[model samples]
Target: MKKTAFIFPGQGSQYIGMGKDFYDTYACSKEMIDLAGKVSGIDMYHLLFEENQELDITKYTQIAMLADELAVLKAVEEKGFSSTVNAGLSLGEYAALVASGVMTPEDAFKIVVKRGAYMQEAVPTGGAMTAVMGLDNETIEKICQETEGIVSVANYNCPGQTVITGEEGAVSAAADALKAAGAKRCVPLKVSGPFHSDMLKEAGLKLEKELEQVEIHDIQTPYITNVTADYVTNKNEIRGLLKDQISSSVRWQQTIERMIDDGVEVFIEIGPKKSLCGFMKKINKEVSAYHVDKIEDLDVLVKELSGQE
Candidate 1:
């Protein structure tokens, strides 16, 4: 039997007017948008459909991205397509929970609102992140350990791409060391803070308290967690994993590999950009990857995945 996976992208994939097509074309999408507004208390239409700096900010980015992703996913599911497995990167995990039936979309929206605010408010001074290209994770990890200050790997994105985060000085020093160690490029990320680093542990603790207020139900489909890069079998582990995910390295590379190893042949990236699709090509060439950010993209997906269903 063939299996399909719904992979969602995180923060950097956001853009203005992301789910406009879906919102206009599908009642499900419109309901999602309205529900997000009711739960998040943000002007959903203005925040996502119009240009604004806050859309890129952490506090607003998480919910906006989630709303957009959920709208897209709902539109896809309405077309009679579904997935065997699911996974998301960083902030995208909340959407995964919603897709898997582990949490209601309304509850997820509420949690994300607080999650985003907590992360934004917890940004440490002088914190930074940098992408290390063309370097192995082992080498980058070793260098980050050797570098002074609170530097550490933030994301294991792909085979040759890893993101390191920490205090600005530490990240800069680590980038220099990584470059000298033969990294092809050490690009500084335009981010608000050292997300996924130990510096954000306080934020994780705060998120844990928020998680306690929500109810988690049994999952309908297995989803890979970024923190463990493994399948979440028991719903009991979801909350802790989400909490730890705040200050933990997003094991995206490992998560995708685990899904592929488990026989996921079709990966549909349901977000604004082809970020996860791009990563899929780098991670593995054998599996088919598609993106459904716009309504027109669904035409191609229908043609390609018609046989799979």
Candidate 2:
């Protein structure tokens, strides 16, 4: 039997007009965006369609990314396609929750709004994140330790690609050290703050309080967690894990490995970009992967899911 996993993309996947085609074609997509706008007090369509690339701040980026991913998911659902397992990276995790029926779309929108605001305010001092390639995790960890002043590994993206985040100076020094240690590249990411690090602890704390007011239910489908790199089904544990995910390193590599170990053979990335598909390929080339970010892609995916391709 073939098993499939649905994964969602995080912040960096957002583009100027992501999901616009779906938004224009599907009434549900427009209604979802409208509801999100009402709850978030953000003109989501404008932010996603009109904002300048440089103006897409982290605060706005989170909401837009969530909305776009959800829009794509809705389209997929309307076509009667489903998956056996699901997971997401960073902000994409919230989308996963929505997909799994663990969180309502409205609640997901509200939480992401608060999450983005808190994350922005939490690191008011402004920080930086960098992706180091061609380096093993141990080498990256050593470089993080060698650099002074609060630098730490934020995301273990893959075997040879890890992202470090922290105070700007510390991150810069760490990047230089990683290069000296023979890293292929240490490129600074265009993000507003140091995410998934201790720097976001304050944001995590604030989010915990907000989380209490939101409703959480058991996942309808098996879902992987970034904090634990394992499957979580209990509602309480899932809620707690989501809170901790704010400031914890995203164990993406571990999560993917665990999914594969559990028998996921086909991974479909449902979102605005193919970022997760790319990552999944790197994680396991034997497992087939596909992405549905355009109308034609969705049509093709529907066919593939129906065994018509």
Candidate 3:
């Protein structure tokens, strides 16, 4: 029996026409998309299937990304293949929560609508994020801590790639420091805001209010949280971690490492792109990684998983 992990990707992975294949193939996919539209009060079909600049905006990006991922996830489950554990990055966490049965997709959909809006509203002006490659987490953290402003590590993406976020000035200063500390390159990211940084604390607080309105059920499958990079078995920890996730570093590398350690032999990424699969390669090369973004990808996945059985 091979233990598998169903991983989901976050914001940057979304694109127009992302889940059209699944939507056309599975009734459950269409139902979930419609449900997301109803809960978020946004026309998910147009938002996802048509060309629009709104898909890139934070307020709309969050829910749209999750809806696509969930559509694919439901389709995968329909094939009778499941995961031993699950996890997702940032916005993708909501999809993982739905997969884990901690909350209904309807509840997550509604909350994600607010979550996106609140995060967009809280995006501080003049904030910036940069990817510092070829630097260890300890050195990056040291530079951020020693720097003069709100700068800090945002994502520990993989072994050598770390993202730092904060005030534009502080981030720039940290980039200089990281470069001087033998970093390979410090490239600025063109994100709408400095996500997963302390600057978003107010946004996290606002999201906490929205989270209170949702009902959290018992966990059916365990999942690792980006906030702690560890498995969360107890459903009680879900709410607080979600709130904190807005203002905390995304420990993605650690989360994947933990899953690999816990016997996740295969990682099936159910989403629009192979972003998580790319990360998996940098994190660990031994585990088999697959992604389902198109109808053709589903065929390969079914054959592989069914053969495993």
Candidate 4:
């Protein structure tokens, strides 16, 4: 097969009724969705399909997004599709673990439910995140360092866009500094917490203890870690890496660059939306990128990759 990588999206990309089409079309998708609910005890189907306000809540959104990604992945795998490697943005990393065969679907669902809750509990008030667009990374870093507060870079999303998170006042001050430094725009993100900042170290510590209770299998396929932007080789490091990833900056731009440097020509975004694909365009437009959400999309992907392979 051509060197290909399967990419998944994180939160803020989810919407209600995301994977219903897959659930209704594929037996495996239905089983996978039900399995998430059975393991997590979250009534996932009702939350994803029926009217529920919990879909936007942090605790529920994480699990719901994972289930939808896994459901779509199940159908894609059923079609005999596979990737040389896999990666996910943030919460989507759980689905990448399942797809890479380092974690079982059952354990993923169980761990994710707890992960979501832990993160929710750790969400401190008066925290904020802002997207600094059309600015270079060095300038953003300099401004963040100059700012006096808990502010720091949260996510290195793409070439021209970076997200900073910290105390609300600090973030606001940093936004002003970034704009003064010639940034095109500094847009505030509507998120519950200052994710990917040191503020969530408590959540990571809580998850570490919880992770010890679960089982990690031998890796069948390698995937990139957002914290380090490198491929995970040993199963033992998973616990610590995941623990630190909670509070560390998400090196998404570096992760994509590493994959491209390693000759991963095709990237497939499997999830609720085309967010990852959007990022891919900014990273390397010459590399082919595809998204698979519906059954029709899978069909298109198969036809598209057939000749490439």
C-alpha TM-score for every candidate: 0.98, 0.95, 0.98, 0.98
Error of 1 at 167 (Å): 0.6
Tell me how far the alpha carbon of residue 260 in candidate 3 is from the true structure, in angstroms, after superposition: 0.9
Q: What tens-digit string does per-residue lDDT give for candidate 4 at 1-309?
A: 789898999999988889999999999999989999998888987899998889989999998999999999999999888999999998989999999998999999888898899999999999999999999999899889999998999999899899999899999999998999899999999999998888999999999999999899988998999989999999999999989988899999999999999999999899987988888899999999999987789989888877543
For candidate 1, the TM-score is 0.98
| Model 3 residue 294 distance off true place after TM-score fit, in angstroms | 0.9
Residues 240-276 of candidate 3 have per-residue lDDT tens digits of: 9999999999999999999898888999999988988
Better of 1 and 2 by TM-score: 1
Higher lDDT: candidate 3 or 4?
4
- Model 2 C-alpha lDDT per residue in residues 35-106, reported as the tens digit of each score: 788889988878877757632677888888888888888888888778888889999999889888899999
Please identify model 4 stretches exceeding 4 Å from their true place: 307-309
Q: Against the unseen true structure, what C-alpha lDDT does each candidate score?
A: 0.92, 0.86, 0.91, 0.92
- The local lDDT score (0 to 100) that residue 294 gets in candidate 3 is 89
For every candidate structure, what is the RMSD over all alpha carbons to the true structure, in angstroms?
A: 1.3, 1.5, 1.3, 1.4
**Residue-level lDDT tens digits of model 1 in 175-216:** 999899999999999999999999999998999998999999
Which runs in model 3 stand beyond 4 Å of their true positions? none
Which pairs in model 4 have colliding backbones? Answer: none
Mark the 10 consecutive residues where model 4 has the least summed lDDT.
300-309
- List runs of model 1 lying over 4 Å from the truth: 307-309
Flag the better candidate by lDDT, 1 or 3.
Answer: 1
